[model samples]
Target: MLWLYLHFPHLLLDHIRRTREETGALVIVEGSGQKVIQACPEARDQGVHGGMRLKTAISLVPELGTVRADQQQEARILEDQARWLYRYAAHIVLVPPDGLMAEIGSLQRLYGGLPAAWQTVEQALDERQLIAWPGLGHTPLAARLIARAGKGECTDDKGHIQRTLGQMPLLAAEFDARTCTRLQRLGLNTLGEVFALPAAELARRLSPETLARVQKIQGTRPDPQAPWQPPHHFRQQADFVQEIEQSQGLLFPLQRILAELEEDLCWRQQETDSLLLVLQHRHEEPSRLRIRTSGPEHRAEAFLNLVRLRFEQHPLRAPVMSLQLSVKRFLGREADTGQDLLGESQDLNEAWHTLMSRLQARLGDQALQQLSPQADHRPERAWTASGVQRNNRPAATMNDQLPRRPLWLLQGPQPLTEAPTAWFAGPERISGGWWDGQRVHRDYYIAQLHNGQLAWVFRDVRDGWFVHGWFG
Candidate 1:
């Protein structure tokens, strides 16, 4: 089974910026630095293109709308789109900020074949007001290339993969800029020309190696892709009456989101063990917040409890526009009487969700937070405050018996004036990983200091005494 790879090479950052700034205006964004990111179709019609210098492109179409490409922002929106599309296909491969590939082989059968599946996907995207060109083929590469060449629909051909692909320009092969130029100069502008060349001869002609790539795209060699998998059976979402800012605003919104999720859990006949919430903000990347249950839960109230506690301590830093919740792990659903209550229980969930909504209306995403585990063994390294739905694990947990640790560690250890330890544990000397050049070598000690602060101190073989962490 091949795949449906959709390419949006021209859906550049300029289009987004312009679409926001001037509706119906043709825009082509060129990154200020070295790389070209996007050129609008209108700009392309004027002979502008991706990778063309911004100034040169403007010279081609003096009136062309231009903006510096925000690669980060474009990528964020693309990811959010990918996240939403997970509901359609379990396996989705994002082709970065502009495109995606979905394993539609299995989906085709479910949707009653290729065309039907394509239509279903198109319809879903339409609801979101996003347009994508779909290309169906036996391989991910083939599908992607054909789609970029603007093949809107795949003709039925169980065996005509090469023939269908023969029509596309060679640039669709994802060749390097120089290779593409070389192909054009040689009048081998089409895939058919490239395909006609004997593999051995073609390999010998290319620089930096082309034999392997040629073989992969030609289907003579297999190119494997690791498909993206959506988490099993859990999601939470909240629709804001208005966009929100501040960590305080999330409390109420999350309340309703949890309530809706509680119902979804019931319908799925599953109990959530661990769930994640993805928060999307206007013009910024979405953040992820995840919670793990000590045990499986179907109770809406209990689920909300954890989210509430997390929000109380941390709030949003920026205003959020939308919220998405997903369950990464879950257990079998078991009916609970509390959630089954007629109206009052549901009301509480609604109230809490409402409160969160109001808080977000004013506080923004940066004001809200949830503590996530850290990987480091240090106490202060235990957790970090992250956006509600941000996915960052806690610091590494090393052997607890390594040494005495501190509960409260300074953000950056403060310099101590005088030595205050009554009893000292032997210094464990360790250092040297300066390849990237942020080097540290210290003799660490467990000391009961003067002010009754049991602290972790280290003396660099050179820098004398420096406090590292504290055991509150």
Candidate 2:
């Protein structure tokens, strides 16, 4: 079986740096915060290197940004990278903290060759701004060792792989310090020298566990790796080293995560109408915000715009420590209705939804409403204001069969001072409201006022005349 392994030297550092616009020196310190485990180019440009003491690094670059190294964070980011790689290769085995092993032998024909498949993964990492070293081998362990050493290549030749593997020193073979020292003292410096010894002699010289590791790397023993499958839903979070005091600061981090969501949605050929964003605070309860769109949407720019609006409407109550974005429910993507099948023109509904989503984000959802018809026949009582309901099909109508009504309806009845000169329509009766105790009993008419204005007048049972509305 052919295997491909990708090694990320500074996965966490790359992830954190991409979240902001600043180019200041940044370093990932050891868990204990005493030493630097990873440093960015800017930090290295200022003489800050990995394995340097944290105090020295800070001294070199006084404005250096420091993030404490974390195993869980690195593992999570590694899985995220695997999720993206899964699009190209199906059989993926995640190597925790910063590596991925993909069995690409089966894809030899799918991508034209193993080198082409390797190139696809390389391009994907480049597009994501991640630093990766790729290695190819017949065994998982061999690929991992070569990748870590930055000596990886695309050749599948057994001789080439063996010659490369033969040159790896005992230290790079993943042996314990004692074993490497013992081998070095015995003048066995490289794996090739160690392999030159007889099987029985090598087994007697090395421990059983070390012997097993060597056999696995040589492909004489099985190295079973469970394949990773992606989740049905999408979720990602960004933890910050520094607490963000302003609500706007959260946008930079959210931008990267939302972009991931967009990519995932596009890959699935589905869209989401809602997203849940939870902002963690140091001392206050976590603030949860649900961002909704007028319709199913997969574009990152649209999601970011809506989130920006939500931030403007709701300010941060406390300093944010982390940001979590999740989407559990996804809707099937609808066909672009406003476009031709040939794909020359674009969809109009897409533009409409963009506008509605932005407007609803700026104003509260409840602030925007739609007018719907009520059961009452009274002009004022015949319609009601309700929340806007967006859908593809037309709205079901209940008042379409009702008598002709003016486009403009008056709010209250005004007393008429003079009688009408002529009448065009009828005394359309609308006299029922006793159910809710607001009873109405009046005779309505359409007439022209003495001032030459078309009006809707009504006289109550008590003989009081009032102009209820005007026809425009």
Candidate 3:
């Protein structure tokens, strides 16, 4: 079986640095803050290196920034990476503190070849702004060792893998200190020298556990790994090294998260209509913002635009230390919107929904209302304002057989002093409201008055002719 290993040499340091907008010499120190464990390129250029005392490194570069390493945080970050890798490979093994191993033997055919599979992972890492060393091997242990030793290369040839594995020094084999020391004493400096010894002889020289490790690395023993699975819901966050007081400052990190979300949605072939954004603060309660779309949405630009509009409406009340975006609800994949011969959407439903979403974002949710026809027969109560609902079908048109109605209806019917000069359409009787206390009995007509104004006049059976509404 072929395996791909991803070794993150500076996972913690990279994770911490991505939050800042400025570049500077930075290092992640040990928990005790005595020595540097990881340093960025800027720090390395300034003569800062891992294993150097923190004070000495600071003396070399006075402005060097340091963040203490946290094992829990590192583990969380590793799991986050695993979540991302799961989309490409189904069988992923999470190696604590720095590495990941995935069995890509089954994926090679699906992804075309080893190069394409490797490129896919590399592209994901690059987009995530992660620094990873990828290595390929016949076994997981071999892959991890090669990646950690910085000798990673894309190759499925077992001969090449064995040759690369043999060249690695015994120190890079991940053997225990006592075994390594004993092997060094025995004049075995490289993995090839150790493997040259007979298995029986090596078993006699080393403990059963260490012997098994060598066997696994050599693909003689099984080293099965449990695959990592993603959770049902997506919750991603970005922590800032510097607190941002303005809402605009949150957009950059938010954009990164939204892009990842768009990729995830595409992978799942699903969409979402709601998103929850939580802005963490240092001393105040987190500000919560709920972003809703007029319809199921998957595009990152659309989400970002709506978020920009939301920020404009509701300014930040507190300085944000970090931002968390989550989506728990997932909608089924929408049907493909048919395109015309030129490849543009033939239906205007999507465009209308987009317009409504933009309007909702700019104005309050309640600001926009849709007029829907009611079942009432009374002219005044024929239609009512209702919440907008996005649908593929166009609004129902008025039937030609139905009586003509005015576009502008008066608040109340007024008595007409003079009769109509001419009648365009007439004698449409309406009688309803028996269930309710207010009953109506009238004969409505479309007529033009003496002044040549078309009016919707009705003759109330109990009263006289009254002008009810006007036509545009």
Candidate 4:
């Protein structure tokens, strides 16, 4: 299998700065035991580094701005990119905040050749203003190392992978400075020298983990990767020659894209569950627009209508050059109820689409959200807001818990002056996320409050009482 590897050294901060259009100002996140989580290139240019003291970063940049790192936001962006890449290949593996590795061996035939496949991947990234150094090899680890080391076009044709990898400094594999220094001391500086050694001898000399790392890079061991799934059949596109400045200019292009998508869906014998619309601009980052039908739908007019509703309520920040519409998520084929005199299904779908489209055209993409259940049994952590196009359902465990959940839960738990509950149903306690050490052990309860409202409450063993949630 051909493994495609990517690495982004400053992915989190780069993504945050880009998406937020935050330039010149530096951002520092003091997360998980007050460690600096990310820093922008501009900040780095001024001598700020990840894990640097936030106070020191500010001292260096002076104008540094900061926000708590939102790993969820970064993860969502990665998920979207994975979905887009899925168009060109079957298996995509997420390497988290900064990387992705994909299996594209089977796609070589479909895209013509390895080079062409790389171009397709490049184009997808180009459309998103994302830069990736891509490398192909037999092992995921080898591909990742090559990509990180800037060997964009490297291939493992004649052990060139092993050779190229050998030439690379040990640090290229993300090994710690101590390990690299240790290897340098033994004249095993290059990965090739390490690879050339007898496995048992190397294991004896350094550590078994050292041998395992070499084995992974050499493809002697299986690298388990979590695969990404692409959405089912759907398509949408926008054509524009003249730049559209005003918000309303988006409508015609969106309608055109929806029309084409409708026709495409009809031909494919499919319906869409979630539609993702990307508005590519001439001078700025693309605006992401998305819409999810209440259920599976194939009616072109209805799809366009929902998007129109979203757009009409939301306005634009930049002029659109062209639009690309695609199904980010979907369900299987379904029978289309053509036209009816009652028009109940048709009218509702079309009306809903139109309303959503107008809202999206006017308000921008972040205006609308759908709710999803979360995995934690704690009612305060029971649900999350999701974008309509990416309607992620909650995990199975989320619904099976005995915790009486609230119909309405505050964004954060409300503190109570006194403790009311003596017995806890779930002294079912949790602790130790404390490596970053923001540990808490709460005695959670499903209790009846004085006002007759069923509340999900918790008492931190150290702190006092906090009303965590409510069950109406």
Candidate 4 residue 86 Cα shift, in angstroms, is: 1.5
Candidates' TM-scores?
A: 0.49, 0.79, 0.76, 0.52
- Model 2 ranges with Cα > 4 A deviation: 181-187, 239-241, 337-346, 371-387, 392-472
What is the Cα-based lDDT of residue 95 in candidate 4?
84
* Reference-based TM-score, model 1: 0.49
Choose the strongest candidate by TM-score: 2
- In terms of TM-score, how similar is model 4 to the real structure? 0.52
Candidate 3: regions farther than 4 A off: 32-34, 339-347, 366-386, 392-472
Task: List model 3 lDDT by residue over 136-254, tens digit each.
Answer: 98889999999999998888888888889999999899899999999999988999888778888888878878789889999999988877878887777777766788888889888
lDDT of 1 by residue, 11-42 (tens): 44422422232333244444554434555556
Cα lDDT tens digits for candidate 4, 291-318? 7665677777777667767666657768
**lDDT, model 2, position 242:** 79
Task: Give the Å error, residue 12, model 2.
Answer: 1.1
How well does model 1 score by local distance difference test? 0.65
- Displacement of residue 328 (Cα, Å) in model 3 is 2.3
Candidate with the larger lDDT of 2 and 3:
3
Q: Which ten residues in a row have the lowest lDDT in candidate 2?
A: 338-347
Which of 1 and 4 is ahead in lDDT? Answer: 4
Which candidate ranks first by lDDT, i.e. highest? Answer: 3
TM-score, candidate 2, is: 0.79
lDDT of 3: 0.88
